[model samples]
Target: MPTCSAHAVVDLDVTGATISKHLYGHFAEHLGRCIYGGFWVGEDSSIPNEGGIRLDVVEALRALDVPNLRWPGGCFADAYHWRDGIGPKQDRPVMVNSLWGDVEENNHFGTHEFMALCELLGADPYINGNVGSGTVQEMSEWVEYLTRDGDSPMVRLRKANGRDAPWKVPFWGIGNEAWGCGGHMRAETYADLACRYATFLHNHDGNTLYRIAAGASDDDLTWTEALMKAVSCLGCTSRPRGLFQAISFHYYTFAGDGISKSPAIGFTDEQYYRTMVKAADIDRVIAAHSAVMDAYDPLRQVGLVCDEWGTWWEVEPGTNPRFLYQQNTLRDALVASLHFDIFHKHAARLRMANIAQTVNVLQAMILTDDEDRLVLTPTYHVFEMNKGHQDAVSVPVHLVEAAPAVTVGDQELDPLSVSASTKDGRALVSLSNLALDTDTTVRLDLRGRAITATRARILTADKPQSHNTPTAPDAVAPADFAVTTRPGAHGSTELTAVLPPHSFAIVELDLA
Candidate 1:
């Protein structure tokens, strides 16, 4: 328990990349209560719903300015038939969710319900198609049904379902985890299938699709290389650009041996440090995949989509094991901040990222109970504070005097994480102190701009494993932070603040 010191510099004029808003997107799957009680409470229920879509959930997510939402899957998308989740709820078919659990899916929340949810939240819909068991024609018609206008079989079906105008669907996924739950196909075989599927996923009525192909699991660069190689045209004057717009990969962090994972709470200090090491390793994972992509697509035409990424832990005791529900803690918030910092650094190639299931699931922003109660998790506050970075210009942050790295067993962990961006004549600098028991004072020299005023906020709790429940919803939340300002070398401004251990903070500057 010692005091640490660090120094960093932020250059305002050296901005090149605009952080894509889609990078802050979210994922929703049809697993356990994620769909039934988490989002959809049924129209007849007393929880105050709109078209069977929970209004409270929409209201909570709207505050974060959700950019986009991926639907019907992680693994469920590959087995889902778009036709099942549309039309009348009473007449819709019921199927057993074999992937997550053997629970019967009543098809209550389907295509129209999902679109309604998106409209309510004003978020773009990114649909993942069924590639494992669905046909090319089936996938093609689903697009037509969702986005096409004028006369057609799909349009007729849509009109019969009580929708007149075509919805604006921007992003689509060819499949999900083709190496596993999506299908047991090899990388080469999936690549060929992806090409065939992308060829037929046509743009209808001026609605263009950014189709993403299912990519590697963790560090399997061969999967990414195979997808890029399949789309690239060698020995030709120019390569194709629209065969597939992007590729996706999934990564999850845990601290346990083999399939077992550390519990969400009551974990030891060693387990906590080990999880931080695993979370921070995403930087290496992204760099490795980006290198492979740069070789195949030198011009950076293809984007990287991390559609599934978050912390996975043992399920809450006494809950359905297949539900994938775990409490979000202060440590989870630090992990999120670390990921966003790394994501901002690679904004040039990384276009979109959706955190693994959004509500009542792995590292969710909001957790709810069977009754009319909800609690915003610590991770939710991180998203709200970092919302300023959406679609903003990325500024370079250089650590002049780096923080001392903490050694955990055989792994070394950098306890200080930082990222900065500017938008609307204001600059936002996000920092996190990952050390478990040491306070850190950070000095930030602001270059290329004159700062007029500054405001700061921080999120932390008594312990790293501290979480919020229905009784103490505000146990872990954000509060105003104090900072000192002075003159720096070469007529620059200096901002200094003492960041608490295991905390995340953001400084907002009014740039002149």
Candidate 2:
């Protein structure tokens, strides 16, 4: 392979647009430990739980300031019947989670439990409706059960289920992965189903529910264009409004053959670079999709929600592969930061995004063992570092100098992912050196705008192949950064730090 040379300015000032609150959203599915041991511990378990929702997991998520959480599945959403999860736990039939494992989904943790958990975390609930095996009335009644205070059949059932009033869940997904998991419908077919479902979703609070339509995979431009035209004809512009408030998109970073069930922890530079290459495409995917949306609606009002994203590999050997479990390493952490930088690159139109699974499933922010829970993956640390960009406006900056290129297999990747944000006269820039083989010297040209170095954090491991275990949790912990200031030409204040191979870093600066 030939060496690639590049120097491009990342002017964050390109658009002074604020990001939507949905950008900080996350997803949780009915896969493996994500539910049973991850976030929900039944009343019989020794784990301390509030109505079966694990207290430790909820506490860990609160620290990250988690904005929203989508329940119940990626594929599970289509099969789940909300009513079965309500009423009486004993009377509710035990159903098989065919989408995940052949395990029984004992209806112990129901709708009320989830709402109670979401309330405690202060994170809004985004429920993906079952369009594949459900009805408009069922979806409508779910909205009523959660959002309506009136005396309806669902509300009556909710009261009987031990809840006095409705639980307001503002964000509702019309469907999930219509092209694959959710019945694999054509765009036109899914669009029609979305129109019907969205029509029945009652926005009780008057706040328009963020009704997200299922979108395309990777570069399926046709899928997105078809949906946009469908929405246009479906009629949100007729003043009475349209069924869709947002159009959803899904993407994942998988190494090797891209088929799931890849190994965890012990990976080569080839696998690491391939993962980064996949992650780096998030921005391009959003941009290209947004352009298609613009052709139909110039205002760019339709939101592009990246609902399912993260690193996917096979589960640990003895563990269930369908569970989608893999260890979080410094490599995964950098991938998280890289995607955040990409999202900020298009903050204007790319309103909401969510990582695949929040705990113990796929790309989880936190993992669990028995009653004890830990922030397992590098993705968790990246969220801690980039929390500032959660709901902040994108203040673009022009990135200068030639960045080293990393290549593996047949793909090439940029070593650094850069994004900037300005608020209250302070310009904060986050740059992640995503190279897994070596550290690159990152020179930030702030133009003499000196600010107090507000401490830096680095997440690394003793070995590149290290994985977190029950006995050793701190194998990859953050350390006091080597923050050295450098004097540069033309009002430029440069700072240098070592971003470990397959690691992540963040620098905070104030404007002069």
Candidate 3:
């Protein structure tokens, strides 16, 4: 393949929406070792933990400035009972995690433990309430147990469990996937259930809840329409803030084949292109959902939350099939970059998003072994590098000369993706080149700003499939990239960088 050339113009003056820091949120569920070994290593373990919450994992995630963490689920949330996980550890009941590997859940990591983890990471707690097999009273009491203070049955129970102060929980979920693992209900049925649940999810002690109704899978716009229609008929003239604050949907990138997914590593070039195509299609999916929402909510009062997303590939050969653990490679990093680009563009309607799982699961940021060893994946570096864009005002990036497209069968994949944002007198521009063999030189006509200084960083490896293991954790880490700044036409600062194949880069400009 030949080298490609791409040109883009960044409008520094035309800032659109604030890219929510919650968009960089993460999900942690009870599946696999994600809870047991990934985050909870037992308070008695010698692996150096802070009250059974692994210190190393907490310290690693703290660097990303994690905004919010969704807990106890994907499908696991529907089956989980908050009451079972609270109080003394040894006294807690143990149940079979029937959804994920037939392993027993000791209920050691309960409500108090999750809130403790959030406090350590300085992130807001996004608790997913049980809706499938749980009653409304159970879900209502769980919220009160966590947030209500003064005098109440739940508050008394919370104090009895060793907590006197109320915790501030801003985000809550009505259910998981109500259409499938979350109880296989129809769209309209789930909509009614969501309204009923949200009614009793009262705010307590000045703590407001941003309730998110479990939304569609992939392209199931009917689910979104059902929720929107339900909210429209609820007698709310303006926003749907009272009934539900947001609607959440899940999207996972794969090779697009119906049956098997491409391996996380050792994938062919064709498979890589196909994955990129699938990743890029999220833009259209978000647009379609937003349009459906616009019909009922033109003012964009209700937020769109892509609560569960990221690549889902086949598990490692020796790992349990239900564990959902997979290696993260350069391709995974590129996929993340592509999603962030699309997310930044949709920041107005898109309020928050959480990657599928944070550790030892599908497209995780950190991978852990059986012992005390841990390795940061390439996807972690992307989050760290792009952390500057959190809550920053997104600026417009117009492509003048687009990157060459790679054709994989009937699908065409653009090798380049870009997004820009400005915050605190500085501007950040992120770029990703998806081509497996070609280098792309990207030119940026930085309009409406004078650059005092420029800094650049790039994350790439020799191959798209290259990944980091415990022995070589920095195999696909980011490093200082080379970017040239020169005078451009019409008083704009011109910047250029040659991005390698399967590479992701960010340019930070100190604007005048």
Top-lDDT candidate index: 3
TM-score for each of the candidates:
0.98, 0.92, 0.98
Q: What is the lDDT of residue 91 in candidate 3?
A: 95
lDDT of 1 by residue, 142-173 (tens): 99999999999999999999999999998999
Error of 1 at 28 (Å): 0.4
- For model 2, the run of ten residues with the poorest summed lDDT: 1-10
Clashing pairs in 1: none
lDDT of 2 by residue, 1-512 (tens): 12222333333244477765567788988888888788887877677887788887887788788899889878898999987887667888899998787889887666887888789889999889999888889888888878877687777877876888667677888878889989878888987888888888877755457788888887688778877887674333442246787888888887755847456677876777777788887778888998888777667777788888888877867887678877777677777788887787788788888888899977788877653746555677678767766666676566566566666667677787777776665555676766555666665555535555455777666455665666777676666677676665664565665565666677666555
Q: Is 1 or 3 the stronger prediction by lDDT? A: 3
Compared with the true structure, model 2 gives a TM-score of 0.92
lDDT of each: 0.91, 0.75, 0.93
**Model 2 accuracy (lDDT, Cα):** 0.75
Per-residue C-alpha lDDT of model 3 across residues 259-287, encoded as one tens digit per residue: 23668898888888888899999999999
True-structure lDDT of candidate 3: 0.93
